[model samples]
Target: MVHGGFRVWSGSEPDFPRQAEQVRSLLGAPDNPALLPPQFVAAALTGIGGMLITRSRADALVDAAFALPTRDPSVILAVRHAANRPGATRLTLVARDRPGAPDGTLVDLPTDWKAQESVFATDSIAIGEPGSEHAKQARQLQGQIWQSPPDNLYPTWLYAPVCPASMSLVALHGDRVVGFLLGFQSQPDRDGTTVLESQVMGVDPDYRNRGIAVHLKHQQAIMAGMLGIDAIRWTADPLQAGSALLNFGRLGAFSRRFLPDYLPFRNELNRLPASRLRIEWTVAGEDPRTELSQHRLHLRESVVPGTTCPIANDGPMDLQITPGNPLIAIEIPSDWTALQQSDLATARAWRTNLDDLLLRCLGEGPDQYLITNAVIHRGRVFLLAEQATNNLLRLYS
Candidate 1:
C-alpha cells in the first residue's frame, strides 16, 4: 500500500470491462477505434490498466456542463479504453452532430466550443483546492515522494493556508489524494508586479504518465489568471529531461538563469548536485500551445536538422563551444533517474558538462541566451536556446 491513505488499485479492478464500456457509451463511441485526443490515447494504451473511472464518476467530471444555460444533452465528457492496449484509457469531450437521429455519430468536440474550462478528469481524478483532510493526504504524499529529513520537510498545513485558495491544488482519485501542487504569491518586484512561485509538485508513482502533472499546471494557470497574476515562476533540475520538456516544450516557459547548488541538501532519490534552471511562464500572453508549435517550426527552418549536441555512449559527452552563435542545442539523458541508478559516474559527468555549458551560454551580458524549448528528434533529446534578438523569440515576447 502507498502512503498518503491512497490505495494503488490493481490493473484488474472490479467490473473493469463494464466500467470501460460505460465510458465509451458516454462518449457515443459506437466502436473503440474512434478518434480522440492523441495524448489521452498514448497514455491509456501504455498505462497499467484500462479505464478505472466509473460512469457516475465520469459524469461528475462533466457536471459543469449541466450548469450552462446552453447545455446540450447531446454533448458530454467521456473516456475509452484502447482496444489493442488492454489497460489503456482515454478521456475527452464528444458531441453528437445529429442529436435526433438514432444512429447519430459522436465526433470530437472543439476545445473552444462554448466550454468554460477543460476538465482534467482522467481516470476519475479531480483537481481542486485542498480542505483540512485533503491537506493531510497531500502532506503524506509529499513525504513519500521527497523523503526529506524532518527539518527539510515542508510545513504543508502551516504554509498552504497562507497561499491563495486556488494556488494550492490537490488531485483526488475518489477519496484518496493522488497528487498536489503547492505555490505562493511572490513579493512584489520593483515594478510592484507579483507572480505565483510554484514551490513543488508531485504525483503518485502508479499514477504518472496519465497527464496528471500537465493538468495540475494547467489548472494552476487558470487560477492565476483569475487572481489577476500575469506570470508564474519556478525552478527545476536542469538535468531532468522530462522537466525540461514539460517546462519549455509543452508549457512554453523560458529560462535565462542557471543556479549551481541551488539547494544546500541532496535528495536520496537523485543524489546529483542540486543545480537548477529558473523558468518564467507568461500566463497572460499568447497561448502556450500556439507559441510552442510556432517556435518548433521556426527552429526547424532556421537551424541544422541534426544540431542536437552529441551524447557519448560511455563517459561524459565532449562539450563543443560555439561562441557568438545565435542558437545552441544541449542534450540531456531522457531518463536521468534510471541513468543515475545504472551508472553514477556517467551521470555525474553529464551534469558537469551541463554546468559548464549553461553557465556560459546562459550567463550575463550580450552573450546571454534563453533556453526556450526541448524536443526529441530521432530518439535524441535536446534543449534549444537562443539569443534574445531572434525573430521567433521577439514575437514570443
Candidate 2:
C-alpha cells in the first residue's frame, strides 16, 4: 500500500504558494468554487500530499454538500474527498441533491450538529453503497489509510462495479463520507478460489469510534455471504491493541500467520514495523459464530507475561522467549500510535526489536506461525500463538 506525492505548476511558473493558499479557502467554500476558483482544486490535486479534515461532522457535511451545483438535475447528493490538504485534514465535499429529495430515509442529520475537537461519529450514522462518482474519494482515503501517495490508491476498476469483482461500501453523515470498506473476490489460484479478500478499509480521522469501522467490516461480510462467498481473509497490524480487540474479541476472526514488513512505514502516523497478522472469517453455514466462538476458546490461554517479550519495556516484567509451548504469548506496547508520536526514536527501536523477536519466535519464512488470539489486560497487549498446528482444540486442555 503506497501513495505518490505530487509537484504542482501553473502555466510556466511553479505557483505552489498561491495554490496552497487557495486550497485553504476552497475547502471551506466548496459550494462557492467561485469563492476561490476551480484552479485551486486542480492545484491541490497536483500539489504536495495533503488531507482535508473538517473541524466537525457538521462542517464536513456542509463542506461536502457545498459541492452540489444548483443546475445539475440528475445528480443526487455528491460526497467526495478533496485531494488538497497537506499537513492538514483532507476535505470532503457534498456536491449535489438526491433524486426526489426523499427525506427521513437516511440517518437523520441534525441541523445543529456540533463541531468536534476530535473527528469521530456517534452511533446515529448512515451506512450504504456508494456510486461510481465516489471512486476518486474512496481511492484517496484508501491511500491515506496506508499513509502512502495518492498514486498508490486503488483504481476505479476495483470499486466502480465495472469489473464486478469487488464490493465497496461507505459510511456517511449527510453528504459527508465518514468511512469505507473494500473487499474483492480472491483470484483463482491453482486450487481455484472460494474466498473474498478484504483489501482496504479506513475511517475519517474525525469520524472513528462508535464502532463505525467494525460495522463496515460486518456489512462487508454480510454482503460476501449474500454473494455466496465462503470466506474472507485480511491482514491486521499486530502492534495495535484496539484493532486486535475488534478483530479477535468482537469479530472472532483468527490467525497464526505473522508477516514482517508487509506494509512499509511512511508518514508520522504510520511509522512502525511493517508486521501484520493474517485474519480469516468463514462466512457460510447456519451460524458462523458457533465455530468462531469455539476457536476463540482454543486460542485463549493463560499467559506468563514477559516470558516472550518481543521488546524491552519498563513494565512489571522483563522476559525471555519460550519455545515448544503448546500456547505462546508476545507482548506489544499499549498504545503504539501514541508511542510513535511522543517518542519516535523509541518507537523505531521497538520496531527493530519486534523484527528480531517476532522473527525468532514465529519464524521468518511464510506460514511459520498461526496467530490464534490476542488480548489486552493489565495495560499490556499479548498476541497468542502456536506453531502451525491444526489440533488447536486439544492444546486448550
Candidate 3:
C-alpha cells in the first residue's frame, strides 16, 4: 500500500517471476509467463498509487474495490475516496444528474460534509414564504423551542421580532435553517443607508443536495430588490464550502469580521466548533430577478410530499407523470438532530436501503425523476408530475 504518496518497501526487491506469481495468486490472474509483463507490474503499482492519492482510477478498479453489485462504480468510488480522506472538512457537489448539469450540481469540499455542523445561507432566507411547510420543517430541526396551543403554531413568528427587517426571507431544509439576511432601517454612521446581513444559514442532514436552501436565498435576494432593502449583510463559517461559494464566488459578499467563534449562540446552542464570518450585500447593480425566476421554476419541479415509496395520500399534487418503468421516491430523514438524537445504526441501515433504491431508479432512464417539493401534510406525502410520450401521465396525488 502507498502512504503519503510514496511506496513502502519491506525488503529487497523480489524477482519478477516470483512477484508475478504472487500477483497472479492474489488477483487470480493467469500464471503463464507470456501472460504477464514486467512493465505491467510497474503499471499496476503506479495505478494503485494514483487511486489512493488522486483518486483517479478505472471503472474496473472501482468495481473491484467496492464490490458493488450495480450502480455506477466510478462515481461511487470517487465519492467514497473524497469522503473518507483524512482531515476532510466538507463535501458539496450538485447532483450531476440534475436537469441543470455543472451549473446545477454545485458541490463544496470537505468542510460542509461534517455530520454535526449546521449551515446557514443568507440567500435562502430572502425567498422562503412565511409559514410555508419548508419554514416549519426548518424551525423544528433547528432545535428552537416551539410554543403552541397546537393549533396556533406559526414558528416563523417566533423569530420575527428578533429577526432583522432586511431579513424578509428565510429558508430551512434538512436540519439547518439558512439564508437569513440581516439589516436595520437606520444607522448613525451612515444615515439613510440600508445594510444587508447574513444572519444564519445551513443544510439539514436529510436535505443537503435538493438545493432547497440555495433556492430560498436566491429568491430572497430577488425579494429584497423588490422590497427596496437597498443592502444586505450576513456572516458565514469561513471554513465552509457553501459559504465560500455563495459569499465570494457567487454574490461577492465580502468578509468584514474575523473573530474566533463570533456567534456565541451557535457555540452554546450546538456541539460543533464555531468561527465568525461577516459579509455585506450591496443590492444596487445586482439583478436577482433571473435567479428568482429560475429558483421558483426549479423549486416547483423538485418539491415532493411524502417521505417514502408508494406516494402517500394527501393534498392535491400539482403534476404527476410516470415513466416507462415504475419510478419511486423515498425520503430518508438524516437531519443533525435526528441523527444525533436517534438510533444511528438503524437510521444508517434505512439510509443505505433508500440510497440503493434511488440508484436503481436512476439507472432506469432519462425519464426517471426525483422530486423534493413533496410536502408532508397530515401524515402523508404529496407528489407532482406530468405525462410523457405514449403514457397518460398527469399530476397524481
Candidate 4:
C-alpha cells in the first residue's frame, strides 16, 4: 500500500527476517549496507545499532562517510523489525517530508513544499468559520462523511447566516473543506449556565488521524468559552473506541447518560440500535488524565475482586453490582472494526448488551454511575465509572 509517498510492503513467513533481507536485496540494497541508528528514520529501537540503511539519498548519491541529515528520509531495510509484530515483516520505502527537530518542532518549510510533500503535517490546515465562500463545501463535506440523504442535511443557507448562539467551525486544507463542527448554545440549565450543543462533526477520511478533529473541537471549546459558555456537549457511538478515547481520554469529557437507539437508523455506519453515549466536555476543566489517575488510585484502594466485568461474546452478560464499591470497570472490544468484520453477530450482541448495561448503570439519581475515564490496556478497552455524588458534576461544571 502507498501512503503519502511511502510504499509499504508486508508479508508473514516463518523466517520473516530472512524474507526481509531478501526483499531488501531485491530492492537494490548495497553490498555492505551501512549500520544506521533508529533516530534517522524516526523510530525507537533498543540495544546498540541494528537498522540497515541500504540507501540514504534516493534521488542523488551521497558519500557513505559524510554526515547525514538528522532526520531525512531513506530506503531502510529490515530484519526482525521492532515496529511490527512477530511473523509480520514489513519494509518501508518512504519519500515523505523529513522528521521534525529534536525539540518537537517542524522545520521551516515553504507552504507549497509542505503541501506537496508532507503526509500527516496539519500546519497547512486553516481552522475558522466557513464564511459564504466555503459554506457550500462544508455542507457537502458533512453530507459525504455522514452519508446522509439530502433531505436530512441542513440547508446551505442555514450555514450562511451569522448567529450569536451558533458557531460553525470548518477545517480547510488549501481550498478544500475537509472537516467541520456545527454547534449552538443550549438553553440555560437550573444552575443558570449554558453549554454549546455540538450536534455534528466529521473529518475527511483521507485526512484523519492528523489531529484535525481534535483541533476543531479545541477551537470550538475556546469559542464557546468566549461566548460565556462553560461546556460543550455531544453524543457519540459508545462502540467507536477511537472516538471514546478522544472524547473521554484525550478531551477531558465525561459521560453520565446513555441513549439506546438514539438514532433509529440502520445505515452502514450506524449499526442496529444506534446507541450513543452523551459526552460533556467542560471548556475549562482539570486535565482528564490527572482525574483518571486519581480515580484509579481510589479504585486501587477500594476495588474488590468482583468489581470488573469482563465482557465475553459467547455468553449472556450478568453485570455484578457490588454494594459499597463505588468504582466499576467494564470491558469493550479494543478493535471494534476487526470484531465487526470477523464476527458481526458478536458485535451486535455487544451493542445490545452494552446498551442494557450502561442504561442501568448510568441511570438518573443517587445510584447512577459516571464514566470518569476510558483506557486501552493490553489490547483490551475499558471504561472506568464511579458512582454519582452530589459534587461529582462540579468537576466539569
Candidate 5:
C-alpha cells in the first residue's frame, strides 16, 4: 500500500504470512528461520524494521512478527512501534556482546563527571613587604655564608635590590626553609607594561608536599594581576620536578631557551647542579593570562659538546683578562673531549683557567660575575657573564 511495498491491516490477516515470507526472503533468510540468541535476534529484527518502515510499508505484519511475547521483549516492541509510526526511530542498543554470551557487556557512564579547567584563580599574598612575618622568618633562617672572606661576613645578602618592601617572599613551614619564592618587579615588556620576575625559589627537604608551593604560586599570580602588571616572568631550575610542574604545568608557562651551567659560583656553592629556565606568563592576550612559561637548559650537551673543546689546528691560545674585567675569551681545542674525558694535563689546564677567572671576578665584590650563558659549537665553550664591570669570578677566594 505504501511505496509499492506490501500492506497489512491486522496480525490475523491472511496476507501477513505472505508479507513475512517476503521480508524474510529480502533479508536472505532460509525457508525455516534459525533460532538466534535473543540479543542477535533483537538486533537483526530492529535493523529489518528500520529498513521496512523507511520504505513506507503499510503492512503491520512486520511489526507483529517482531513483537514476540517474551521476557526482555522491549527491543521487539520498540522496533514494532517504530515501523508503524511515521518518522519514528527506535533507540539503538550498543551492547558489547550478544545474548547468552559472557565476554563483553554494556557500560553506563556517570552523569556527574566533569573535567577541570587548565587555569585557576585564587587569593593573593603580599611578598617581600615590610612587617611581613614570612620574610622576617626567611631572613632569620638564611643559610650561613660559606667560605666568607675577611671583608664578607655571615648572613650577607648574596643577590641584591635589597628592598624589604619591593621583594616578595613565599612563606614555607617545614624543616629549614623547604619552599620559598623570591621575586622582584622588572621593566615592562614592549608595551610599557610592568612585570614581576621571580628570582629564586627554595624548597626545604621535609615539606615537599601539602601543596604549599601551589598555594604560594597561586598567590603570586593573583598579586601580579592586582599590581597592574602585565606579565610575570621567572627562571626555574629544570632538575626540580615540583618547581617545573608549578611553572610549566599549572601556570601554563612554556620553555623558550636554555642556558647551560650558567652559574660560575656553582663550584663555590659546592657544585650545586644549576640550570636556567626562562618562563613567562602574559596577562593581556587571553583570560587568566597565557604564555610560554618553562624553558629547560641542558648543561652538558649545551655548554660543552662531546664533553670538551676540540684541539684546533692552530693549538690553544693563552687568554688573559685582568681582575674586575668583564670577560676573558679563550680559544681552545674544538674537538677535544670533555674535562672528565680529557687527559689529566688537558683537564688541569682548563681547571686552572676557570680558577684564575673566578678569583679575578671574586676580587671585585660579593655576588658578582654570574655566568649567564654558555654555547658549545664544534667543541668550543663560549661563556657569557652577567656583569661587564664588577666581575663575579673574584668573589670566591
Candidate 6:
C-alpha cells in the first residue's frame, strides 16, 4: 500500500484519508481515484498525517464545496483553484468552483471577430463576436455573472459558447462584455426546417432591467429570420413570473409542452423536481405576436377565467385542475424566487404538484392541447391555453 514517501489510502488511516473517503462517497464514486487531482489527495493526506487541520474543519470545507448543487466536475476546478492559491484562504475557499478552464483568448471560435455578423446594436450594448482584447475580461465576467441576482446557477452551463452556427453572441458595453447569448442552431429537420435552441441567455445583474435581454432576444430573432429558422425552443422555470411575462406577454413565446423535472436540481437557486416549460418561439408561425396581443386584450376585456387553482405563499397544492374548460387558469406565486429563498420545502412541494397539473394541461405532442397565452390578473397569474383540437400541429400550420 506504500508508494515511496506516501502509502495509498487504507481504511485504517485516520482523519484525512477517511475525510477524503467521505468526499469520494459524497461524489458517488468511492473507488474512483480519478475524482480528485493528485495535489488535492496529497493535501488531504498531508493535513491528515501531519495533524494540521481537524476532521471537523476538513469535513466543513469538503461539504461546502460538494454542496454546490452541481455535478459539473468543476467542483474539482474549485478545489484546484483553492489548492493553487498560497494565500487569500478566505477568498479562495469561499470562491465559486469552475471546471478546468484556460486563460487568454479561446482558440476554438467558430467565426472570426470581423467575419461574424453583427446581430443587434443598442446605444449601450452590442451583440456580436468580440475581438481578442476582451477574453480575460469575459472570463472574469463569466465567473461573476452567476453570483449575481435574477438567475444564478443556470449560467454555469453557459461557460462561453458551446453550440455551433454562431449562435454564440456576446453583449459588449464599450470594451467589456456584459451579457452573453450561449445559443446554437440545432440540427435541421426532414424538410430542412431549421431550429435555434437558446441554451442560456443572461445579462449582467448590474446591467439588467434595462431591456438587455429583450435586445439580445430580438437580435437573435433577426439573425434567425435571416438564417430562415422556423422556431427557437428554450426552457425556463415556470415559477419565474418576470420571465413568464417577458416570454409569454412580450416576446410571444408559449409553453405548450411541460417537461417534468427536466432540469437537474443541482444549483442552489433551483428547487427539487426541477420542472421546466419548453417555450416555443415560432418565428414563422401564424403570427404568435399578433395573436398574443389579441389574447392579452381578450383577457382584459370579457373572457371569464373558467378554472382557478389557488397558490399560496407556501406554494400550489391540494389543487383543482379543470382540463375541459375553454380557458383554464392556474394561479402561481407572485414572487416564486422569494418564496424559494424563504421556504424551500414549500417550494419543492409546489414544484412536485405543478409538474403533473401543467403536463395534463399541455399534452405530449401535436396530437394534444396547446397553450395560447399567459395572463396576469388581480395579483394572480393564469396560464391561458385553450384545449385545442386533437391535432395541435394544425394550429401552427
**Highest lDDT against the true fold, candidate:** 1
After superposition, candidate 2 runs with Cα above 4 Å error: 1-122, 143-147, 189-193, 285-292, 295-318, 363-369, 393-397
Q: Write the per-residue lDDT of candidate 5 for residues 188-254, one digit (tens) a residue.
A: 4456656666555544435555565666666667766776766766665433334554664455454
Against the true structure, candidate 5 reaches a TM-score of 0.35
lDDT of 3 by residue, 1-397 (tens): 3333322221134553354334333333332211222222332222221121121144222111110000111221111122122222111122212211112222232211112222334433223443333445544544333121222122242233222222434454333344332222322124544333334454554445656555655665665667565665554543344445455435534432343433323222223334334455566534446553354345444544333234411112212324442324333332423442365565344334433333333221355442212233344322222212122121110
Clashing residue pair totals per candidate (backbone < 3 A)? 4, 30, 57, 0, 33, 1
TM-score of each: 0.64, 0.59, 0.33, 0.61, 0.35, 0.61
- Residue 146, model 3: lDDT of 18
lDDT of 6: 0.51
Worst 10 residues of 5 by lDDT: 151-160
On TM-score, the leading prediction is 1
lDDT of 6 by residue, 166-216 (tens): 355668887777877655445454675566767666677788887877777
User: What count of clashes does model 1 give?
Assistant: 4
Q: By lDDT, is 2 or 4 better?
A: 4
Candidate 3 segments exceeding 4 Å error: 1-127, 132-135, 144-155, 158-191, 266-273, 285-397
In angstroms, give how far residue 91 of model 3 lies from its true place.
42
Local accuracy of candidate 2 as per-residue lDDT tens digits, 1-397 = 1112222223234564454345445454333221222322332222211222122233332221112211112222212324343222211222222221222122222222222222223466776776554555666676566575543455443444433435777777776667787765453334533566676688887776778887787777777778766677787777777777777666766664567776543554567655776777666522535654555654454444445423333332334543555555666778888888898887777776666655556642333455656777577787666566555433321
Q: Against the hidden true structure, what lDDT does model 1 obtain? A: 0.58
Error of 5 at 321 (Å): 39
Name the better of 1 and 2 by TM-score.
1
What lDDT would candidate 2 get against the real structure? Answer: 0.52
Better lDDT candidate (3, 4): 4
